[model samples]
Target chain A: MYVTLKDGIHDPQGKAVKDALSVLGFNGVEQVRVGKYFELDIAETSLETAGPLVNGMCDQLLANTVIEKYRYELIEK
Target chain B: MYVTLKDGIHDPQGKAVKDALSVLGFNGVEQVRVGKYFELDIAETSLETAGPLVNGMCDQLLANTVIEKYRYELIEK
Candidate 1:
Protein backbone atom coordinates (compact mmCIF):
# COMPACT_ATOMS: atom_id res chain seq x y z
CA MET A 1 0.00 0.00 0.00
CA TYR A 2 1.11 3.54 -0.78
CA VAL A 3 -0.51 6.49 0.96
CA THR A 4 0.30 9.91 -0.41
CA LEU A 5 -0.99 13.38 0.29
CA LYS A 6 -3.52 14.68 -2.18
CA ASP A 7 -2.28 17.36 -4.56
CA GLY A 8 -2.18 20.91 -3.13
CA ILE A 9 -1.58 19.60 0.38
CA HIS A 10 1.42 21.07 2.16
CA ASP A 11 4.06 18.52 3.17
CA PRO A 12 6.35 19.99 5.77
CA GLN A 13 8.37 16.78 6.08
CA GLY A 14 8.94 16.74 2.35
CA LYS A 15 10.11 20.33 2.46
CA ALA A 16 12.49 19.52 5.28
CA VAL A 17 13.85 16.62 3.31
CA LYS A 18 14.31 18.74 0.21
CA ASP A 19 16.13 21.39 2.20
CA ALA A 20 18.35 18.75 3.78
CA LEU A 21 19.14 17.42 0.30
CA SER A 22 20.09 20.91 -0.85
CA VAL A 23 22.31 21.33 2.15
CA LEU A 24 23.95 18.04 1.22
CA GLY A 25 24.63 19.51 -2.29
CA PHE A 26 21.91 17.76 -4.28
CA ASN A 27 20.27 20.57 -6.23
CA GLY A 28 18.58 18.66 -9.02
CA VAL A 29 15.24 18.01 -7.35
CA GLU A 30 12.23 19.99 -6.19
CA GLN A 31 8.67 19.66 -4.92
CA VAL A 32 9.42 16.59 -2.84
CA ARG A 33 6.33 15.04 -1.22
CA VAL A 34 6.54 12.20 1.25
CA GLY A 35 4.18 9.36 1.96
CA LYS A 36 3.87 5.88 3.44
CA TYR A 37 4.52 2.62 1.62
CA PHE A 38 3.65 -0.71 3.14
CA GLU A 39 4.84 -4.14 2.17
CA LEU A 40 2.15 -6.51 3.35
CA ASP A 41 2.39 -10.24 3.80
CA ILE A 42 -1.24 -11.13 3.64
CA ALA A 43 -2.57 -14.53 4.58
CA GLU A 44 -4.72 -14.75 1.49
CA THR A 45 -3.49 -16.54 -1.64
CA SER A 46 -5.70 -15.10 -4.35
CA LEU A 47 -5.56 -11.51 -5.56
CA GLU A 48 -9.30 -11.65 -6.18
CA THR A 49 -9.95 -12.22 -2.51
CA ALA A 50 -7.02 -10.17 -1.22
CA GLY A 51 -7.89 -7.00 -3.04
CA PRO A 52 -10.99 -6.10 -1.09
CA LEU A 53 -9.50 -7.40 2.10
CA VAL A 54 -6.56 -5.09 1.67
CA ASN A 55 -8.86 -2.30 0.64
CA GLY A 56 -10.79 -2.76 3.85
CA MET A 57 -7.51 -2.65 5.71
CA CYS A 58 -6.62 0.60 4.03
CA ASP A 59 -10.03 2.16 4.42
CA GLN A 60 -10.40 1.21 8.04
CA LEU A 61 -6.80 1.23 9.22
CA LEU A 62 -4.00 2.05 6.82
CA ALA A 63 -5.03 5.26 5.10
CA ASN A 64 -6.65 8.51 6.03
CA THR A 65 -8.99 8.88 3.04
CA VAL A 66 -9.87 12.51 3.70
CA ILE A 67 -6.45 14.00 2.87
CA GLU A 68 -4.48 10.98 1.68
CA LYS A 69 -5.06 8.45 -1.07
CA TYR A 70 -3.72 4.92 -1.34
CA ARG A 71 -2.84 2.39 -3.97
CA TYR A 72 -1.65 -1.20 -3.66
CA GLU A 73 0.05 -3.71 -5.90
CA LEU A 74 0.38 -7.35 -5.05
CA ILE A 75 3.80 -8.92 -5.37
CA GLU A 76 3.97 -12.70 -5.25
CA LYS A 77 6.35 -14.03 -2.72
CA MET B 1 11.89 7.04 -4.06
CA TYR B 2 11.03 4.38 -1.46
CA VAL B 3 13.11 3.74 1.61
CA THR B 4 12.51 0.44 3.38
CA LEU B 5 14.31 -1.45 6.06
CA LYS B 6 16.36 -4.34 4.81
CA ASP B 7 15.23 -7.91 5.51
CA GLY B 8 15.72 -9.00 9.14
CA ILE B 9 15.76 -5.38 10.26
CA HIS B 10 13.12 -4.63 12.88
CA ASP B 11 10.67 -1.82 12.11
CA PRO B 12 9.19 -0.37 15.27
CA GLN B 13 6.90 2.01 13.42
CA GLY B 14 5.59 -0.79 11.28
CA LYS B 15 4.90 -2.87 14.35
CA ALA B 16 3.09 0.04 15.92
CA VAL B 17 0.91 0.54 12.87
CA LYS B 18 0.12 -3.15 12.69
CA ASP B 19 -0.80 -3.22 16.34
CA ALA B 20 -3.02 -0.24 15.83
CA LEU B 21 -4.75 -2.01 12.97
CA SER B 22 -5.32 -5.10 15.09
CA VAL B 23 -6.72 -2.93 17.81
CA LEU B 24 -9.11 -1.47 15.28
CA GLY B 25 -10.21 -5.06 14.38
CA PHE B 26 -8.47 -5.80 11.08
CA ASN B 27 -6.81 -9.12 11.75
CA GLY B 28 -6.24 -10.92 8.43
CA VAL B 29 -2.82 -9.37 7.78
CA GLU B 30 0.67 -10.12 8.89
CA GLN B 31 4.21 -8.87 8.48
CA VAL B 32 3.23 -5.33 7.64
CA ARG B 33 6.42 -3.45 6.83
CA VAL B 34 6.28 0.29 6.34
CA GLY B 35 8.62 2.57 4.45
CA LYS B 36 9.02 6.06 3.12
CA TYR B 37 7.69 6.98 -0.29
CA PHE B 38 8.67 10.20 -1.99
CA GLU B 39 7.07 11.89 -4.95
CA LEU B 40 9.85 14.00 -6.41
CA ASP B 41 9.41 16.56 -9.12
CA ILE B 42 12.84 16.48 -10.62
CA ALA B 43 13.95 19.32 -12.84
CA GLU B 44 15.12 16.88 -15.50
CA THR B 45 12.84 15.75 -18.30
CA SER B 46 14.49 12.61 -19.58
CA LEU B 47 14.32 9.42 -17.53
CA GLU B 48 17.80 8.45 -18.65
CA THR B 49 19.19 11.66 -17.20
CA ALA B 50 16.96 11.79 -14.12
CA GLY B 51 17.68 8.25 -13.02
CA PRO B 52 21.24 8.85 -11.96
CA LEU B 53 20.49 12.25 -10.48
CA VAL B 54 17.74 10.82 -8.28
CA ASN B 55 19.98 7.92 -7.39
CA GLY B 56 22.47 10.50 -6.16
CA MET B 57 19.77 12.06 -3.98
CA CYS B 58 18.93 8.67 -2.49
CA ASP B 59 22.54 7.84 -1.87
CA GLN B 60 23.36 11.18 -0.28
CA LEU B 61 20.24 12.21 1.60
CA LEU B 62 17.08 10.17 1.15
CA ALA B 63 18.10 6.66 2.16
CA ASN B 64 20.40 5.39 4.83
CA THR B 65 22.21 2.81 2.70
CA VAL B 66 23.37 0.86 5.75
CA ILE B 67 19.99 -0.48 6.89
CA GLU B 68 17.58 0.91 4.33
CA LYS B 69 17.25 0.32 0.59
CA TYR B 70 15.67 2.61 -2.00
CA ARG B 71 14.11 2.39 -5.44
CA TYR B 72 12.67 5.13 -7.66
CA GLU B 73 10.53 5.41 -10.74
CA LEU B 74 10.70 8.42 -13.03
CA ILE B 75 7.10 9.42 -13.50
CA GLU B 76 6.29 11.93 -16.21
CA LYS B 77 4.62 14.87 -14.58
Candidate 2:
Protein backbone atom coordinates (compact mmCIF):
# COMPACT_ATOMS: atom_id res chain seq x y z
CA MET A 1 0.00 0.00 0.00
CA TYR A 2 1.15 3.52 -0.81
CA VAL A 3 -0.26 6.53 1.03
CA THR A 4 0.38 10.07 -0.13
CA LEU A 5 -0.64 13.57 0.76
CA LYS A 6 -3.40 14.99 -1.43
CA ASP A 7 -2.57 17.33 -4.32
CA GLY A 8 -3.41 20.57 -2.55
CA ILE A 9 -1.57 19.61 0.62
CA HIS A 10 2.03 20.77 0.64
CA ASP A 11 4.80 18.33 1.45
CA PRO A 12 7.48 20.05 3.47
CA GLN A 13 9.61 16.97 3.79
CA GLY A 14 9.68 16.56 0.02
CA LYS A 15 10.57 20.19 -0.39
CA ALA A 16 13.42 19.82 2.05
CA VAL A 17 14.68 16.80 0.15
CA LYS A 18 14.61 18.63 -3.13
CA ASP A 19 16.51 21.56 -1.68
CA ALA A 20 19.07 19.28 -0.08
CA LEU A 21 19.51 17.41 -3.35
CA SER A 22 20.17 20.67 -5.12
CA VAL A 23 22.70 21.66 -2.48
CA LEU A 24 24.39 18.32 -3.02
CA GLY A 25 24.54 19.09 -6.78
CA PHE A 26 21.82 16.69 -7.96
CA ASN A 27 19.68 18.91 -10.08
CA GLY A 28 16.72 18.73 -12.43
CA VAL A 29 14.35 17.39 -9.76
CA GLU A 30 11.19 19.01 -11.01
CA GLN A 31 8.94 17.56 -8.34
CA VAL A 32 9.14 15.19 -5.45
CA ARG A 33 6.30 13.66 -3.46
CA VAL A 34 7.03 11.63 -0.37
CA GLY A 35 4.70 8.88 0.74
CA LYS A 36 4.35 5.79 2.88
CA TYR A 37 4.98 2.27 1.74
CA PHE A 38 3.67 -0.67 3.66
CA GLU A 39 4.73 -4.26 3.22
CA LEU A 40 2.25 -6.48 5.05
CA ASP A 41 1.98 -10.15 5.76
CA ILE A 42 -1.45 -11.62 6.32
CA ALA A 43 -2.85 -15.12 6.75
CA GLU A 44 -5.62 -14.79 4.16
CA THR A 45 -4.47 -16.22 0.86
CA SER A 46 -7.49 -15.64 -1.30
CA LEU A 47 -7.83 -12.24 -2.95
CA GLU A 48 -11.61 -12.46 -2.75
CA THR A 49 -11.54 -12.44 1.03
CA ALA A 50 -8.41 -10.39 1.54
CA GLY A 51 -9.18 -7.39 -0.63
CA PRO A 52 -12.07 -6.18 1.44
CA LEU A 53 -10.29 -7.26 4.59
CA VAL A 54 -7.27 -5.11 3.89
CA ASN A 55 -9.36 -2.25 2.59
CA GLY A 56 -11.26 -2.33 5.86
CA MET A 57 -7.98 -2.08 7.69
CA CYS A 58 -7.00 0.93 5.64
CA ASP A 59 -10.31 2.63 6.29
CA GLN A 60 -10.13 1.99 10.03
CA LEU A 61 -6.48 2.81 10.63
CA LEU A 62 -3.64 2.89 8.11
CA ALA A 63 -4.71 5.96 6.17
CA ASN A 64 -6.12 9.27 7.29
CA THR A 65 -8.46 9.77 4.34
CA VAL A 66 -9.22 13.40 5.09
CA ILE A 67 -5.81 14.73 4.08
CA GLU A 68 -4.15 11.70 2.56
CA LYS A 69 -5.10 9.21 -0.14
CA TYR A 70 -3.99 5.63 -0.49
CA ARG A 71 -3.68 3.12 -3.28
CA TYR A 72 -2.68 -0.51 -3.03
CA GLU A 73 -1.78 -3.44 -5.22
CA LEU A 74 -2.08 -6.89 -3.74
CA ILE A 75 0.49 -9.43 -4.81
CA GLU A 76 -0.11 -13.09 -3.97
CA LYS A 77 2.58 -14.63 -1.88
CA MET B 1 12.46 4.39 -4.94
CA TYR B 2 11.41 2.24 -2.00
CA VAL B 3 13.38 3.03 1.12
CA THR B 4 13.07 0.70 4.08
CA LEU B 5 14.73 0.33 7.44
CA LYS B 6 17.33 -2.36 7.55
CA ASP B 7 16.32 -5.48 9.47
CA GLY B 8 16.38 -5.17 13.27
CA ILE B 9 15.89 -1.39 13.26
CA HIS B 10 12.26 -1.94 14.39
CA ASP B 11 9.38 0.00 12.91
CA PRO B 12 7.24 1.65 15.56
CA GLN B 13 4.74 3.11 13.10
CA GLY B 14 4.13 -0.29 11.56
CA LYS B 15 3.63 -1.82 14.98
CA ALA B 16 1.19 0.88 15.98
CA VAL B 17 -0.82 0.35 12.82
CA LYS B 18 -0.86 -3.38 13.40
CA ASP B 19 -2.09 -2.97 16.95
CA ALA B 20 -4.76 -0.57 15.83
CA LEU B 21 -5.88 -2.97 13.14
CA SER B 22 -6.18 -5.72 15.75
CA VAL B 23 -8.18 -3.42 18.00
CA LEU B 24 -10.52 -2.84 15.09
CA GLY B 25 -10.90 -6.67 14.87
CA PHE B 26 -9.04 -6.95 11.59
CA ASN B 27 -7.20 -10.15 12.29
CA GLY B 28 -4.47 -12.26 10.70
CA VAL B 29 -2.06 -9.37 10.14
CA GLU B 30 1.13 -11.26 10.86
CA GLN B 31 3.66 -8.58 10.05
CA VAL B 32 3.94 -5.05 8.75
CA ARG B 33 6.87 -2.85 7.78
CA VAL B 34 6.47 0.79 7.01
CA GLY B 35 8.82 2.59 4.65
CA LYS B 36 9.22 5.64 2.45
CA TYR B 37 8.05 5.91 -1.14
CA PHE B 38 9.49 8.62 -3.33
CA GLU B 39 7.93 9.68 -6.61
CA LEU B 40 10.42 11.87 -8.42
CA ASP B 41 10.01 13.82 -11.61
CA ILE B 42 13.34 14.65 -13.19
CA ALA B 43 14.45 16.18 -16.47
CA GLU B 44 16.61 13.29 -17.59
CA THR B 45 14.92 10.90 -20.03
CA SER B 46 17.41 8.23 -20.97
CA LEU B 47 17.98 5.37 -18.57
CA GLU B 48 21.73 5.55 -19.02
CA THR B 49 21.88 9.16 -17.90
CA ALA B 50 19.08 9.04 -15.32
CA GLY B 51 19.94 5.90 -13.41
CA PRO B 52 23.07 7.28 -11.79
CA LEU B 53 21.50 10.69 -11.39
CA VAL B 54 18.65 9.31 -9.32
CA ASN B 55 20.87 6.87 -7.48
CA GLY B 56 23.19 9.66 -6.45
CA MET B 57 20.19 11.49 -5.05
CA CYS B 58 19.22 8.44 -3.05
CA ASP B 59 22.72 7.88 -1.73
CA GLN B 60 23.04 11.48 -0.65
CA LEU B 61 19.62 12.44 0.63
CA LEU B 62 16.73 10.00 0.19
CA ALA B 63 18.06 6.91 1.96
CA ASN B 64 20.08 7.16 5.12
CA THR B 65 22.60 4.45 4.40
CA VAL B 66 23.42 3.94 8.06
CA ILE B 67 20.06 2.37 8.91
CA GLU B 68 17.92 2.35 5.76
CA LYS B 69 18.30 0.59 2.43
CA TYR B 70 16.68 1.48 -0.86
CA ARG B 71 15.79 -0.05 -4.21
CA TYR B 72 14.33 1.51 -7.31
CA GLU B 73 12.70 0.57 -10.59
CA LEU B 74 13.03 3.10 -13.36
CA ILE B 75 9.75 3.71 -15.09
CA GLU B 76 9.89 5.92 -18.15
CA LYS B 77 7.26 8.60 -18.26
Candidate 3:
Protein backbone atom coordinates (compact mmCIF):
# COMPACT_ATOMS: atom_id res chain seq x y z
CA MET A 1 0.00 0.00 0.00
CA TYR A 2 1.27 3.42 -0.91
CA VAL A 3 -0.13 6.08 1.39
CA THR A 4 0.33 9.76 0.74
CA LEU A 5 -1.04 13.10 1.74
CA LYS A 6 -3.98 14.05 -0.42
CA ASP A 7 -3.64 17.17 -2.50
CA GLY A 8 -3.93 20.47 -0.67
CA ILE A 9 -3.48 18.81 2.68
CA HIS A 10 -1.17 20.35 5.24
CA ASP A 11 1.87 18.15 5.80
CA PRO A 12 4.40 18.94 8.49
CA GLN A 13 6.70 16.32 7.07
CA GLY A 14 6.44 17.85 3.64
CA LYS A 15 7.38 21.16 5.13
CA ALA A 16 10.35 19.48 6.71
CA VAL A 17 11.30 18.16 3.30
CA LYS A 18 11.26 21.71 1.96
CA ASP A 19 13.47 22.77 4.84
CA ALA A 20 15.86 19.92 4.14
CA LEU A 21 16.00 20.76 0.48
CA SER A 22 17.00 24.31 1.27
CA VAL A 23 19.71 23.03 3.61
CA LEU A 24 20.92 20.58 0.96
CA GLY A 25 21.27 23.46 -1.50
CA PHE A 26 18.62 22.09 -3.76
CA ASN A 27 16.94 25.20 -5.02
CA GLY A 28 13.58 25.64 -6.64
CA VAL A 29 12.18 22.67 -4.72
CA GLU A 30 8.81 24.10 -3.94
CA GLN A 31 7.12 21.29 -2.06
CA VAL A 32 7.34 17.79 -0.70
CA ARG A 33 5.06 15.49 1.28
CA VAL A 34 5.79 12.11 2.80
CA GLY A 35 3.82 8.93 2.15
CA LYS A 36 3.86 5.29 3.15
CA TYR A 37 4.39 2.32 0.88
CA PHE A 38 3.46 -1.10 2.18
CA GLU A 39 3.98 -4.60 0.82
CA LEU A 40 1.84 -7.40 2.23
CA ASP A 41 1.90 -11.14 1.86
CA ILE A 42 -1.34 -12.79 0.75
CA ALA A 43 -2.12 -16.45 0.21
CA GLU A 44 -3.64 -15.97 -3.19
CA THR A 45 -2.96 -17.73 -6.48
CA SER A 46 -2.88 -14.66 -8.66
CA LEU A 47 -3.38 -10.88 -8.88
CA GLU A 48 -7.10 -11.31 -9.42
CA THR A 49 -7.58 -13.10 -6.10
CA ALA A 50 -5.02 -10.90 -4.43
CA GLY A 51 -6.81 -7.72 -5.46
CA PRO A 52 -9.95 -8.19 -3.42
CA LEU A 53 -7.98 -9.64 -0.53
CA VAL A 54 -5.70 -6.65 -0.47
CA ASN A 55 -8.60 -4.24 -0.80
CA GLY A 56 -10.27 -5.97 2.13
CA MET A 57 -7.05 -5.75 4.05
CA CYS A 58 -6.94 -2.07 3.35
CA ASP A 59 -10.58 -1.37 4.08
CA GLN A 60 -10.78 -3.53 7.18
CA LEU A 61 -7.25 -3.30 8.53
CA LEU A 62 -4.38 -1.72 6.62
CA ALA A 63 -5.83 1.75 6.09
CA ASN A 64 -8.35 4.00 7.70
CA THR A 65 -9.55 4.78 4.14
CA VAL A 66 -11.37 7.80 5.51
CA ILE A 67 -8.64 10.20 6.58
CA GLU A 68 -6.10 8.70 4.22
CA LYS A 69 -6.13 7.58 0.63
CA TYR A 70 -4.16 4.45 -0.21
CA ARG A 71 -3.37 2.37 -3.27
CA TYR A 72 -1.60 -1.00 -3.46
CA GLU A 73 -0.02 -3.34 -5.95
CA LEU A 74 0.65 -7.01 -5.28
CA ILE A 75 4.00 -8.53 -6.09
CA GLU A 76 4.50 -12.29 -6.41
CA LYS A 77 6.99 -13.99 -4.17
CA MET B 1 10.30 0.36 5.99
CA TYR B 2 8.94 -2.65 7.82
CA VAL B 3 7.09 -1.53 10.93
CA THR B 4 5.95 -3.99 13.54
CA LEU B 5 5.02 -4.16 17.17
CA LYS B 6 7.88 -4.85 19.50
CA ASP B 7 8.06 -8.34 20.94
CA GLY B 8 5.60 -8.96 23.80
CA ILE B 9 3.67 -5.86 22.95
CA HIS B 10 -0.11 -5.83 22.88
CA ASP B 11 -1.51 -5.38 19.39
CA PRO B 12 -5.15 -4.59 18.74
CA GLN B 13 -4.65 -5.41 15.08
CA GLY B 14 -3.30 -8.80 15.99
CA LYS B 15 -6.39 -9.40 18.05
CA ALA B 16 -8.41 -8.48 14.99
CA VAL B 17 -6.45 -11.13 13.16
CA LYS B 18 -7.48 -13.65 15.75
CA ASP B 19 -11.09 -12.63 15.32
CA ALA B 20 -10.88 -12.85 11.55
CA LEU B 21 -9.31 -16.28 11.72
CA SER B 22 -12.14 -17.60 13.84
CA VAL B 23 -14.64 -16.07 11.45
CA LEU B 24 -12.83 -17.66 8.56
CA GLY B 25 -13.06 -21.03 10.32
CA PHE B 26 -9.34 -21.37 10.72
CA ASN B 27 -8.72 -23.28 13.91
CA GLY B 28 -5.77 -23.24 16.25
CA VAL B 29 -4.66 -19.83 15.02
CA GLU B 30 -3.71 -18.26 18.28
CA GLN B 31 -2.02 -15.05 17.29
CA VAL B 32 -1.32 -12.63 14.48
CA ARG B 33 0.02 -9.06 14.40
CA VAL B 34 -0.07 -6.96 11.30
CA GLY B 35 2.93 -4.88 10.31
CA LYS B 36 3.81 -2.25 7.76
CA TYR B 37 6.19 -3.12 4.96
CA PHE B 38 7.41 -0.28 2.75
CA GLU B 39 9.48 -0.22 -0.41
CA LEU B 40 11.10 3.09 -1.32
CA ASP B 41 12.73 4.56 -4.37
CA ILE B 42 16.16 6.01 -3.75
CA ALA B 43 18.45 8.13 -5.83
CA GLU B 44 21.57 6.59 -4.34
CA THR B 45 24.16 4.92 -6.49
CA SER B 46 24.63 1.91 -4.22
CA LEU B 47 23.18 0.10 -1.22
CA GLU B 48 25.93 1.51 0.99
CA THR B 49 24.71 5.03 0.27
CA ALA B 50 21.10 3.95 0.25
CA GLY B 51 21.40 2.32 3.66
CA PRO B 52 22.18 5.48 5.53
CA LEU B 53 19.66 7.48 3.53
CA VAL B 54 16.94 4.97 4.31
CA ASN B 55 17.88 4.93 7.96
CA GLY B 56 17.75 8.68 7.96
CA MET B 57 14.34 8.52 6.37
CA CYS B 58 13.13 6.15 9.04
CA ASP B 59 14.54 8.31 11.78
CA GLN B 60 13.50 11.62 10.31
CA LEU B 61 10.14 10.69 8.87
CA LEU B 62 8.91 7.17 7.96
CA ALA B 63 8.84 5.31 11.27
CA ASN B 64 8.53 6.67 14.78
CA THR B 65 11.63 4.61 15.70
CA VAL B 66 10.87 5.30 19.37
CA ILE B 67 7.52 3.50 19.46
CA GLU B 68 7.48 1.34 16.32
CA LYS B 69 10.64 -0.51 15.24
CA TYR B 70 11.29 -0.33 11.51
CA ARG B 71 13.66 -1.77 8.94
CA TYR B 72 13.90 -1.20 5.19
CA GLU B 73 15.42 -2.57 2.00
CA LEU B 74 16.00 -0.49 -1.12
CA ILE B 75 15.08 -1.65 -4.60
CA GLU B 76 16.80 -0.11 -7.57
CA LYS B 77 14.53 1.50 -10.11
Candidate 4:
Protein backbone atom coordinates (compact mmCIF):
# COMPACT_ATOMS: atom_id res chain seq x y z
CA MET A 1 0.00 0.00 0.00
CA TYR A 2 1.14 3.51 -0.83
CA VAL A 3 0.08 6.15 1.66
CA THR A 4 0.37 9.85 0.97
CA LEU A 5 -1.10 13.03 2.27
CA LYS A 6 -4.35 13.95 0.58
CA ASP A 7 -4.32 16.89 -1.80
CA GLY A 8 -4.81 20.23 -0.03
CA ILE A 9 -3.40 18.71 3.16
CA HIS A 10 -0.51 20.64 4.62
CA ASP A 11 2.70 18.64 4.47
CA PRO A 12 5.33 20.12 6.71
CA GLN A 13 7.61 17.17 6.24
CA GLY A 14 7.50 17.57 2.51
CA LYS A 15 8.26 21.23 2.83
CA ALA A 16 11.17 20.46 5.10
CA VAL A 17 12.56 18.09 2.51
CA LYS A 18 12.17 20.73 -0.15
CA ASP A 19 14.00 23.20 2.01
CA ALA A 20 16.81 20.76 2.55
CA LEU A 21 17.15 20.21 -1.16
CA SER A 22 17.34 23.91 -1.70
CA VAL A 23 20.12 24.19 0.84
CA LEU A 24 21.99 21.44 -0.95
CA GLY A 25 22.08 23.64 -4.07
CA PHE A 26 19.40 21.63 -5.82
CA ASN A 27 17.57 24.82 -6.54
CA GLY A 28 15.87 23.16 -9.49
CA VAL A 29 13.67 21.24 -7.11
CA GLU A 30 10.35 22.99 -6.85
CA GLN A 31 8.68 20.62 -4.44
CA VAL A 32 9.19 17.38 -2.65
CA ARG A 33 6.61 15.15 -1.00
CA VAL A 34 7.45 12.20 1.13
CA GLY A 35 5.25 9.13 1.46
CA LYS A 36 5.13 5.63 2.86
CA TYR A 37 5.19 2.51 0.76
CA PHE A 38 4.47 -0.94 2.04
CA GLU A 39 5.24 -4.17 0.30
CA LEU A 40 2.96 -6.79 1.82
CA ASP A 41 3.56 -10.45 1.44
CA ILE A 42 0.15 -11.98 1.85
CA ALA A 43 -1.33 -15.45 1.84
CA GLU A 44 -4.09 -14.54 -0.56
CA THR A 45 -3.84 -16.04 -4.02
CA SER A 46 -5.77 -13.50 -6.05
CA LEU A 47 -6.17 -9.76 -5.97
CA GLU A 48 -9.92 -9.96 -6.18
CA THR A 49 -10.10 -11.60 -2.78
CA ALA A 50 -7.17 -9.82 -1.23
CA GLY A 51 -8.42 -6.41 -2.27
CA PRO A 52 -11.00 -5.98 0.42
CA LEU A 53 -8.85 -7.74 2.97
CA VAL A 54 -5.96 -5.35 2.44
CA ASN A 55 -8.33 -2.44 2.15
CA GLY A 56 -9.65 -3.33 5.56
CA MET A 57 -6.12 -3.32 6.88
CA CYS A 58 -5.53 0.16 5.54
CA ASP A 59 -8.89 1.37 6.74
CA GLN A 60 -8.26 0.05 10.21
CA LEU A 61 -4.67 1.11 10.74
CA LEU A 62 -2.30 1.21 7.77
CA ALA A 63 -3.50 4.63 6.74
CA ASN A 64 -5.48 7.51 8.17
CA THR A 65 -8.02 7.83 5.38
CA VAL A 66 -9.26 11.20 6.57
CA ILE A 67 -5.97 12.91 5.77
CA GLU A 68 -4.05 10.31 3.83
CA LYS A 69 -4.94 8.52 0.62
CA TYR A 70 -3.82 4.99 -0.02
CA ARG A 71 -3.68 2.59 -2.94
CA TYR A 72 -2.25 -0.90 -3.31
CA GLU A 73 -0.90 -3.04 -6.07
CA LEU A 74 -1.34 -6.76 -5.57
CA ILE A 75 1.10 -9.18 -7.13
CA GLU A 76 0.66 -12.93 -6.69
CA LYS A 77 3.86 -14.67 -5.84
CA MET B 1 14.03 8.15 -4.82
CA TYR B 2 12.60 5.10 -3.10
CA VAL B 3 14.59 4.07 -0.07
CA THR B 4 14.17 0.59 1.37
CA LEU B 5 16.08 -1.75 3.59
CA LYS B 6 18.59 -3.85 1.75
CA ASP B 7 17.91 -7.55 1.66
CA GLY B 8 19.65 -9.22 4.63
CA ILE B 9 19.43 -5.97 6.55
CA HIS B 10 17.28 -6.46 9.63
CA ASP B 11 14.19 -4.25 9.61
CA PRO B 12 12.79 -3.77 13.08
CA GLN B 13 10.25 -1.21 11.96
CA GLY B 14 8.97 -3.53 9.30
CA LYS B 15 8.59 -6.22 11.91
CA ALA B 16 6.70 -3.86 14.16
CA VAL B 17 4.34 -2.91 11.35
CA LYS B 18 3.81 -6.57 10.50
CA ASP B 19 3.06 -7.35 14.12
CA ALA B 20 0.54 -4.55 14.20
CA LEU B 21 -1.12 -5.87 11.07
CA SER B 22 -1.34 -9.33 12.58
CA VAL B 23 -3.01 -7.96 15.69
CA LEU B 24 -5.43 -6.03 13.52
CA GLY B 25 -6.56 -9.39 12.10
CA PHE B 26 -4.96 -9.09 8.72
CA ASN B 27 -3.64 -12.60 9.12
CA GLY B 28 -3.26 -12.95 5.41
CA VAL B 29 -0.23 -10.67 5.60
CA GLU B 30 2.89 -12.78 5.42
CA GLN B 31 5.36 -9.90 5.55
CA VAL B 32 5.51 -6.14 5.47
CA ARG B 33 8.50 -3.98 4.50
CA VAL B 34 8.17 -0.25 4.80
CA GLY B 35 9.96 2.24 2.63
CA LYS B 36 10.19 5.93 1.85
CA TYR B 37 8.95 7.34 -1.41
CA PHE B 38 9.85 10.80 -2.57
CA GLU B 39 8.19 12.80 -5.30
CA LEU B 40 10.43 15.63 -6.41
CA ASP B 41 9.25 18.49 -8.49
CA ILE B 42 12.29 19.68 -10.36
CA ALA B 43 13.09 22.40 -12.85
CA GLU B 44 15.14 20.14 -15.05
CA THR B 45 13.35 19.17 -18.21
CA SER B 46 15.16 15.97 -19.02
CA LEU B 47 15.88 13.00 -16.81
CA GLU B 48 19.35 12.79 -18.20
CA THR B 49 20.33 15.90 -16.27
CA ALA B 50 18.06 15.43 -13.27
CA GLY B 51 19.23 11.88 -12.87
CA PRO B 52 22.69 12.76 -11.63
CA LEU B 53 21.35 15.63 -9.54
CA VAL B 54 18.83 13.45 -7.76
CA ASN B 55 21.36 10.68 -7.44
CA GLY B 56 23.59 13.14 -5.69
CA MET B 57 20.77 13.88 -3.26
CA CYS B 58 20.32 10.22 -2.44
CA ASP B 59 24.03 9.56 -2.24
CA GLN B 60 24.62 12.55 -0.02
CA LEU B 61 21.65 12.31 2.34
CA LEU B 62 18.44 10.84 1.00
CA ALA B 63 19.49 7.26 1.51
CA ASN B 64 21.97 5.33 3.56
CA THR B 65 23.64 3.43 0.74
CA VAL B 66 25.29 1.03 3.18
CA ILE B 67 21.98 -0.47 4.34
CA GLU B 68 19.45 1.02 1.96
CA LYS B 69 19.07 0.94 -1.79
CA TYR B 70 17.36 3.74 -3.65
CA ARG B 71 15.89 4.10 -7.10
CA TYR B 72 13.86 6.84 -8.74
CA GLU B 73 11.41 7.23 -11.57
CA LEU B 74 11.48 10.39 -13.59
CA ILE B 75 8.11 11.73 -14.67
CA GLU B 76 7.73 14.86 -16.74
CA LYS B 77 5.06 17.23 -15.68
Q: Candidate 2 lDDT, tens digit per residue, B1-77?
A: 99999999989988987888888997799888999999888888798998999789888889999999999888888
Q: Which ten residues in a row have the lowest lDDT in candidate 3 chain B?
A: B25-34
lDDT of 1 at A42: 76
For residues B1-75, could you state the per-residue lDDT of candidate 1 as single tens digits?
899999999999889888887887767668789999998887887889888888888888888999999988878
Candidate 1, DockQ score (0 to 1):
0.83
Q: In every candidate, how many clashes are there?
A: 0, 0, 0, 0
Residue pairs with backbone atoms closer than 3 Å in model 1 (clashes) = none
Ranked by lDDT, the better of candidates 2 and 4 is 2
TM-score of each: 0.90, 0.92, 0.51, 0.95
Which order, best to worst by TM-score?
4, 2, 1, 3
For each candidate, the alpha-carbon lDDT, in order, equals 0.87, 0.88, 0.61, 0.87
Distance from true location, Cα of B52 in model 2, Å = 1.0
DockQ of each: 0.83, 0.91, 0.10, 0.88
iRMSD for each candidate structure, in the order shown: 1.2, 0.6, 6.4, 0.8
Q: Report the candidate with higher lDDT, 1 versus 2.
A: 2
Which docking band does candidate 1 fall into?
high
| TM-score of chain A taken by itself, candidate 4 | 0.94
TM-score of chain A of each: 0.93, 0.92, 0.80, 0.94
Candidate 4 displacement at residue B70 in angstroms: 0.9
Q: Which stretches of candidate 1 lie over 4 Å from their true place?
A: none
